[model samples]
Target: NAGVIQTPRHKVTGKGQEATLWCEPISGHSAVFWYRQTIVQGLEFLTYFRNQAPIDDSGMPKERFSAQMPNQSHSTLKIQSTQPQDSAVYLCASSLGAEVFFGKGTRLTVV
Candidate 1:
């Protein structure tokens, strides 16, 4: 079990550009979740996948946030037309239930 993996630990994007973050969940885990954390928002759930299928994305922005799981090992979150307000830590987590593990997170800075 690799726990969780997130890449490009940091990202900087121009306002109105796009940013992509990646995540790899632990082996044999069937549930994956995405979250955004900041001083203002605390932690907000962006989306979740169970058994490689999207379960809910109510917390995601209707305009620019998207998440996907193409396989059992990995997931991705993409933000388009990034804005300064979008700057935050994007975290990915996985779990079976009641016990979830989080990735180190990708810190995004939109300037």
Candidate 2:
């Protein structure tokens, strides 16, 4: 599919381990967003950037969570020392204007 691509549809990590999720946005999109979905929080915005520059990351944890858009084609979200509470469906979305396209997301499970 020509939509956003997120690698490793499902991921399992042990407690205190590390997990890295990858995302490739649609070509020509200038804005990218990272979000986390869970039964408790629903969908929560984690961070976003435009033109590969970080815009806002207010929802991200002050520690152990980070995201980066190193280039136009892709972005990565890394979680260090993952805990069971960190388990969620991480979503990646890209937008050129008001319309945003989303990937299937990477379901992370921390045991």
lDDT of each: 0.95, 0.97
Residues 1-111 of candidate 2 have per-residue lDDT tens digits of 489999889999999999999999999999999999999999999999999999999999979999999999999999999999999999999999999899999999999
* Best candidate according to TM-score: 2
Per-model TM-score, in order, reads 0.97, 0.98
Q: What digit string (tens of lDDT, one per residue) describes model 1 on residues 1-111? A: 667999989999999998999999999889999999999989999999999999999999999989999999999999999999999999999998789999999999999
RMSD of every candidate to native, in Å, equals 0.8, 0.7
- Cα deviation at 24, candidate 2, in Å, is 0.1
> Which ranges in model 1 have alpha carbons more than 4 Å from their true place?
none
Stretches off by above 4 angstroms in model 2 are none
Clashing pairs in 2: none
Single out the weakest 10-residue window by summed lDDT for candidate 1.
1-10
